[model samples]
Target: MRNLTVIIPTYNQKDLLERAINSLISKCNDEINIYVLVNNTESNYIVRNKNYANLHVEYLNTNCGFCKAVNYGLRLIKKSRFIFLLNDDTEVINQIDIDNIIHELIEKGNIFSISLKMLKGNYPNLLDDAGDMYTILGWQFKRGNGLPKELYDRPCEIISACGGAAIYNKKILDEIGYFDEDFFAYLEDVDLGLRALMRGYKNLYYPYISVLHVGSATTGGKYNDITIRLTARNSIYVIYKNLPLPLLIINFPFILLGYLIKFIFFAKKGKGKIYISGVLEGLKNLPKFKEKRRENMRKKKISNIKLEWILIKATFEYFHQYIKRAFYTLRGAKK
Candidate 1:
């Protein structure tokens, strides 16, 4: 068995998939195996491994979105010690970076997940997202997003996981679960981090392991209908699945208020209907989502403290700054 398996789940990105595959081929040391999961009917690239060994491809029959495609592909891999997830639009920019991540994973032993620094494809030097952060409203946001590249250098612990280029312990994941099939695509990483964190496992960010991602190249970018709906559904479903009854009570108001603000923003962009539909559909589907949560939380062997800490640690302070700024602006205007 290989020390690690790099799994890239793809859908309809025939243009960039070859570059992504080549990127992996360039970086992976002999210790890891590369697995590509493709679902789209259009297969673009072919891999001829004369120089490199341990690289494999598993093509699916239908376009099963991303979550199912990954899970489906994962089931076929001979259960390796580590499973690294990289997106079809992302490329490993550095080889030493990947080596460091594998080193950390092996040394840590109990780490459930580790995310790498993801930079935007347009501005390869500028930071796209450092890792994933959880917000108080029970949502995940990419850290250091839109910030200058020079600022994000230190490795740290993150509350949530980033699926763009994250490595997972396969054994732990199989028991905890794979990506929630209901999530289809977006927010699945956040849901997985929440579920795993609830079990006392560590999810971290290794800044040294950096990669570049062409954001939304395969899926939604600014805000399309499918992205809107799944994100909306999963956002509400996340709070339902992870938050306790009391935290849930405290979180509802903020969640609604956040959506209200988002609605106005979407309206300004002429996509108001899309956001509204997502919110409404998410609300309508809450009961079933809640039941899913109830069933999932039962499988964990962690304390409620760790669960709450997951929320607190994963909490992104950036939004708190914006909210604070907004409140002060309102107060100053009143004064």
Candidate 2:
């Protein structure tokens, strides 16, 4: 039984994929296994040149979405205590000790999932997010979004994280279920993290290990109409499925206000009313999400009040004001 199984799910980002593979091949400390699932539709791309002569690399027969591709690899690996669902566009920069992460897991004995410190490529002061967080409303966000790199060293509990890079306890995943395949791309991590919290598990952000993220490499910075629609629809799914009564009451106005502001911003940016389109798609699927949530609540004895703080952090949209102010401070403090 090895300590970890590092899985990277990729589609069409060959250049970044090569760089990420080299970074991991260089820094891993123990005899851990590496699994890379190529989810590309076309027959070939010549993705691996690493000379990983000692690692495991597999390709799915068909191109499944992000969640399903990783799960395919999981079905192959027999035994791993911890599973690292890493992104193909991120690079591990430090010689992270797997023993330390495992030891911390034993010591805490409670945390179910986490993400390493994520610094944006070539922008040391800017953070991709130490981990993911949100409010009760349908606004999923990153922790320390524009905060200085120094603040990332602090370890804390977070609502959820960008699935691009995060660690999960295999046992916990089995308990709660795999990433909701319906969320083909965005907000899947948030949904999984929320499910665990609702069942009394904690998702944390750890800084002992660090990595550089080539953010949004696959979809580029912003997407075409389809990606935008999917993202909008999924964001609403997260809020609808995880929101509890108290936090919903407190944050409903904020959710509406946030989307209205986003609508104007997107319109000015020439993004064709995607905010409205996304909400409508979400509403059309609301009955499905509601049923899942009700079934989940029934199976787990924990009440929403016990998980209120997690809900608040999961839907935090108020942090944008802080982010704008902090970007200036970060620039001033940068070396």
Candidate 3:
């Protein structure tokens, strides 16, 4: 069986898709199968492109959003033991030795996924995402984002792996479950990773494997209405689904504070109303969320304290970054 199957999901970005496909084709060996899910785009667009000749293309008639697109691609592949999820806006920067990585994963038995170092496309010297970090306050952030690349040169455990450029053990995914389609887009990776963690699976951040990502290529660049809405809504779902009832009761205050702070921050960015709308939408779907939460609870293998230990706390550094960003934005506005 082939060791790796790379799944790239694209919405309407044909040019970026071509670049991503070519980069993977050049960097990866022939043993690795690449599947491109052309979601919500006209069939003729892919059919006319000769660039897709070497890659497997699965065309979706309707715009099913990111989560569904990935799940669709996963359904199409059968043989590969490891599945690598890549965003269509990313380019493989180096030749990733799949055999070595697979060996490492096998040796590490508990690791469900390995988060690859994602460098910024515009500034390769800076890091885009080292891995994903989750906090007790029901928030998720990309670790080492905008930091110097050398800062995160060591492998470590992370709360989650970014789906943009992460390798997952296919069996674990089958066990824990695929990305929640209800998420539609943002925070789905965190939701999935958290589920894996609750099921006794670990996620690792491997610095050797890297990719350049042109983030927010599908939705308008970060902090836009669409992204703000989807992310805010999904955040609620993630917290609801993963935390047990007792844990949820204990963390409710922190969760409320987090959402309040986020509302104020996004409001300053002129997305407050949109963000609130998403939050309300999430609350409106509580019945569905509760049902899913019950189902997820059944798969729990770890204690709440153990899971909490893995998550980070709301430290001064976290608030400090936001303060700095707000300061910079105000300064830029004055100029």
Candidate 2: the clashing residue pairs are 134-313, 134-314, 134-315, 134-316, 135-314, 135-315, 135-316
lDDT of each: 0.74, 0.75, 0.84
Which pairs clash in model 3? none
TM-score of each: 0.88, 0.89, 0.91
Q: Candidate 1, residues 1-335: lDDT per residue as tens digits?
A: 36677888877776677788787777665546777887855644554566667777777777887889889867977657778888989888877444566675635656788888889888886678777777665556777776656677887777666888888888878878899887778888888987877776878877776788888876568477777767876787777787767666766776677677777887988888987787777778787776677776676667666666556654546665346546755876799
lDDT tens digits, residue span 124-163, model 2: 6678777877664466677776666786687878777557
In candidate 2, stretches whose alpha carbon ends up further than 4 angstroms from where it belongs are 41-43, 46-54, 223-226, 245-250, 313-335
Clashes of 3: 0
Highest lDDT: give the candidate number.
Answer: 3
Candidate 3, residue 188: how far the Cα is off, in Å:
0.5
> Among these predicted structures, which one has the highest TM-score?
3
**Rank order (by lDDT, best first):** 3, 2, 1
lDDT of 3 by residue, 61-115 (tens): 8889999999998887787788999998998988877788889764558889999
Worst 10 residues of 3 by lDDT: 46-55
What's the CA RMSD for each of the models? 4.6, 2.8, 3.2
